[model samples]
Target: MKNVLIISGHPDLQNSIANKTILDEVATALPNAKIRKLDELYPNFNIDVASEQAELLNADVIVWQFPLSWYSMPALMKKWLDDVFLHGFSHGSTAKLGGKKLIVSFTTGAPAVAYQHDAVMKHTVDEFCYQFETTAILCGLDLQPIVYTNGVSYSARQTAEQIAGQKDLAKEHAKRLITAIQAA
Candidate 1:
């Protein structure tokens, strides 16, 4: 199996139910995987470009794991991408990330039905993730099918049953992520 690198972009993992559970499940299922929690590493949003690039170079499969915020990734994740995926390293002649696989795994508060054309959100989850596809193309990285968990927080009040269900859903999502990485 290729070495997998999970770049977690949850702004506050301690308060998260879905994202944290998924990350834990992935770590347990794939013991050799390297999981990097961006919030913990760069709380000030000051990314260490050189160190991040080095991590990217060492991994064969890169997984961007986070909770969907405002239909996209959190601010720190965007900053990490902007800071670390530089012209030379990720796109230009000096690019070294080619052929590496990228998997986008996330949890969404909105249900899957909400992402449909007739739904309130009016756009599929994949449609919202087009930018990641373009980024993979530009970086010459192989794009893998996304693994996501939806309806994680659709209700404001979470009952014991609902919380348990969310945990189970997260575990399933993590399994799907593992499968995607192994395929990569």
Candidate 2:
């Protein structure tokens, strides 16, 4: 089994009913994987840079799960990257993160329609996540297509429908990530 590391970065996890459910499914499907909630791990926002870097370096597949905040990651999570993913460690000719597979699983407060180029949100999820994708590339990692779901406050029926929609996307993406890691 792959040594998958799932890092969940939601700021308000207690109210994250839907994303948590998806994570549960992912954990069930990938039983041997290691799941870490960053918020829970570094509650005081004092991330151990070396430890986090080591985890990333050791992981065969790294999944970034979070709620989209201002079109990017949560503040502390962004700081986590800034602190741990250093120049020589995560992005250099011999970066430690090279050759690993990176996958982003995200949820948003706005509706899916709002994330369209012609809509108010003004960009597709892929477009919004470009910074992370490019960073993965700089680290020589494979940046898989993102899995995005919208409307965090959706009703029960809506949440189920949205999750079903997201499940297909997540399943396919997860397969690619696992296959890439295995092939490596």
Quick one: best TM-score, which candidate?
Answer: 1
Residues forming the 10-long window of minimal summed lDDT in candidate 1: 153-162
lDDT of 1 by residue, 1-184 (tens): 6888999999988888889999998888889999999999999999999999999999999999998999989999999999999999999998999999999999999889999999999899989999889999999999999888889984732788888898888888888888888888
Each prediction's TM-score versus the true structure = 0.96, 0.82
Worst 10 residues of 2 by lDDT: 175-184
Per-model RMSD to reference: 1.2, 3.6
lDDT of 1: 0.91
lDDT for each candidate structure = 0.91, 0.75
Residue pairs of candidate 2 with colliding backbone atoms: none
